[model samples]
Target chain A: MAAARKKETFWSEPISKVDLQRPAVVPSGTSIIDAVKEMKYNQIGCVLVVGADQKIIGLLSNGDLMHEYVGSTLPGDTPVDTIMTENPFTATPALTVQEALEIFHSNPFRHMPILNGEAIEGILSIRGLMVFISEHLPLEVMNLPPDSSLIATHAAGE
Target chain B: MEGLKEYLTRQDFVSSSEVRWCPGCGDYAVLNSVQNVLPQLGLPKEKFVFVSGIGCSSRFPYYLDTYGFHSIHGRAPTIATGVKVANPELSVWVVTGDGDGLSIGGNHLVHALRRNLDMNIILLNNRIYGLTKGQYSPTSRKGQITKTSPYGVLEEPLDPLRIALASEATFVGRAVDTDPKHITEVLVAGAEHKGTAFVEILQSCVIFNKNAWTEVSDRSCREDRLLYLEQGKPLIFGEKRNKGIILKGTKPVVVTIGEQGIKKKDLVVHDRHREDPVYAAMLTKMDYPDYPLPVGIFHAMEKPVYEVELVKQIKEVTALKGRRNLQGLLRGSEYWTVSNKGKTIKRSTGISSLANDESKVMDERIHALLKSTDPLTASLKNTIGKIFYDYDYKRSKMLSPRDSIASAIALFKAAKIECILVGDAKRLYGILSERDIIQNVVLTSVDRDRMPISSIMRPVYEIMDESNSIGDVINILSISGHRHVPIRLKDGGFGLVTIRQILRFIHDTVEQVEKKESEDK
Candidate 1:
């Protein structure tokens, strides 16, 4: 039965096949403001936190920053680690694409750090994964149900 | 036939002006497509006139090697109508953006389309105002984020195709900028249409609002998302051409071809030339995701072309009236010219000689003269102050610079006044009017709630002294292109003198003159 298996599907492929981007990383002691600037400059949705010895410590997403710093009394110089999610769910390079998708589907976080025995590889965003999959099955990518936002509820007039 | 060199080429349509649109902008593709299509139309390059309103897309006229008019915002349709009406032989084309065409220009566009003028109007809809730096435009999708709509747009977007169909546009089509070949085809078809041909191009402003038509323009999904309407083809779409749309009890339903015994004939046929636009209007509502966005001519019906009919009417009238000239109309048969030797005017002699004759005959002659003469001409020499008092003109209230534009607009709306003096009664600064708002504030990035009235107020250029005659007021008003003028009072203040007030004064004088003439009889 094992020998009868013809070809491996896209879901059974290694996580590396998804081509995860090199995650934007900042030192644990970096300021929240600096982290946000890095995220904006890199045009990424989140930044990964690393402690001394270059081990992944936490993950700071735009949503995390928005909920933690925005409209709050926290000073710009406040450390990012205070607001970041510690021990974030991570994937391994050896993990199958299906495993990564399952983690994203079950978890609330949008970004997952890819780790290779504490030596960081990259980050895998749910959107990035979806885009990769869409390239394979382009037709099914946009075959979504109607978005309510597209429909005009009221007359467009003054 | 003339030599091949005599015919125009695509190179002939390229202008010397440098294309200044942002790199990767959809307008570049559209411009190229238009240039390619024009040479194929077989018309003289000089006969084409491209009129545009204000926007990034409005810059199309400068890049095209033809007669072009970059008219004012939202007035391109009106100017294009005039261009077509005046020169029916010329092929007129109006280029406008979503903000320019669907917002302030909405009324003009509707009228122009409904009139069925022999012109082509291209509306480049990028969903956002790229010229104004990404403000929510009239076609921007609800919940779409922009500079002005940081929290996302609240109002529903206006569908340009639906509006055109509703306006009874003789030719209405849609095309995306990404597909240059398709756009060129649609444009050629539109140019060939005899009546008003309105095409809304789904363009992308790469810098401000990128991928605005991604659902329909993206190479990966375009085949599945866009339904290319052929003249007699059935409405079908999808990568495999398996999914088709069928009308079920007035609602369009997507069905599989072979799954439930549905065939190609069951799909809605493309009937663009159908007289009634009800079917075409339904196609406009079939947007992306739920259904394929229909492109190509959604509706095309033969109608009496405005310019052709107008020229015909003018010709018929001229034949009936024996071609009367302007000089003949201006100078009636009863004109009296006084000689240089101080001779008595012919008409004036009649008035004097009538006194010598019967009083009833004098009254009759005066009444006849009054009928022929303009009543306003007699009051033109009267001082503006006297006219103002005679007409009981109300003093226009002055607004300060500190007032918000919103408040100024409110004042204009509530008071139903054309203009307001932007200063106190003591010192004059400038004037803010509805015209100023329309020309400056509307469709611009100016925040009416935050910006002060002084920001848009025009400095008073034409000022008339209260002692100045009404004749002087008319001269100033005509030269300044303003409907109202500020009258400087002798008591160190200003008064608003309007053309309406002057006309009212003339009307009252005419009534009095007529009453006096009847009393004499």
Candidate 2:
């Protein structure tokens, strides 16, 4: 099973190749509570806040909602922009997962927006990135040749 | 699970809060209907939450005995959304008025509908702001006079039903507050619906907009003006059942039944299950005087509700990917762990090499200052337990993490203290020393407005303990190069000690020695 599993470099793959969230987008001036509801309802990781022209302005996640609303005294009625991380650090669609790793180093972003010029392509969550990398990394790093290694065998499926 | 009789009663949902609405207000009827319908939900009273925005009708939550939140104006839908999303099991309800829901909260309302969350929304269309005494509302009729539009309302009035229809709300209905049975029926249906249910109540504001809906809702004219929609039935109304609606190529034509070859078969059949929404849209647009008003469910269709989809998606994603916890996200990176012999071993791989900037040296300095401290320092031993108490110590002021770094820096300069304790309005966080600020803010050139004081706070363990003598304090000031020594007070508060204070003590002792030596000479 270990021999059957394919090994891949995390940095070499473009972020677009990995599943990026087709974000549930909400308009600016939207309340934080409503924005979070949109994210929860759609099961979307992040709700991208867009301007009047539908350009990305901000983004809110479960973590942001927890910190900004659940932990704070601010009412849920506060506008999305008020709690949303405005103009968050974004990566271009052409950027690789390795580049994403480097970007995370500086920005510490768990969820990074992928932009194709002015328009948003999708969102990349650290969970998705790490999970994908973990599947590929476990076997090769162990350096044990093929056959029934329990951890490697379990991670054999793509 | 709960017993039916234990948590199910109309009185169980009644709140102790004083009912403050004006007597004869339409809100009273809607409130009664909600309380009655709640018992039928079969959920515990604690599982129910009524959220309302600012307005006369927004006060509905306060009168409810169950958990409720009186939220901001025009933001009830948003608040209710939090309550529902955080705990989908909770039967969340939104109570909002015409001005609060339509005018100020229109964005939240439409989005909530579009999302099709599993929650009931009771929109009270009173046509005026009764709380503010008298003001025209968004649903107020065109050419109506009020405090805001005394010259008569110029803009065409908004139709709440039409808005709900366009937003693709799963359940949309209208009922009159004057009719308790009808209101209860609609409210129960809304509560029973698995998706977002919007019911607009045509409530009469006795003081501000008196009899706004009385023309259509009055007993004498109700049979003719009001049209009760029933599934798979012909569109018929009027006291004698004489009036019937027939489609003239999409336009509804009100004609007399059993006259001019107009039979019941010729009437348009109400198709609640129609895939197309043109009929529902038209039905919602119908108004009194010209057309009989629709006072039942205009549209109720099955759609995958938002909360359900969210939960399903999360499960699917979690299965596909892996679990990501909150703490990993907070400190800004995923903490890698390896299972060894059934025990998890955490790896200390930081987020990229970029974080190791020039601050690496300062980080080492900080670690040394914090870790190298022993229980007893050579500078002072017994002096702390006895003599140091005689010296007056200044307690440092604390700042909340929410405060901007710029304001904290300005405050630090004015306070003349080398450092300040950083925390909330209460509670003592780590101390923020001038050295920590100079290293992170000035040397690194970070954004002060965006940065929080918590980011550069000196750890509590690094602080000088009350047991340390003045000698130990001086040693700390020299080694750490911090003018201010934030010490823990005996009462569990934070106090500051400065090099200037120590210098003053030294100068006074030297003066005393010189006078004694001169007298002996």
* Candidate 1 structure quality by residue, lDDT tens digits, B464-513: 77887666665565446565788887887887886556545544564576
RMSD each, Å:
31.2, 26.0
lDDT (10s digit) by residue, model 1, range A1-158: 01222222565778887868777889999987788767766656678888997888899876565455543577778898999999888878888866766666555576788888887888886655644543443212232213212322111100
Error of 2 at B496 (Å): 68
Top of the candidates by DockQ: 2
* Chain A agreement with the truth for model 1, given as TM-score: 0.80
Reference-based TM-score of each model: 0.49, 0.50
Assess candidate 2 and give its lDDT.
0.73
**Tens digit of per-residue lDDT, candidate 2, span B281-399:** 98986787778998888888889999889989999978976676665566664245667775555545464332344445555543443231222221122343233354555435778
Model 1, position B93: C-alpha lDDT score: 95
Return the DockQ of model 2.
0.01
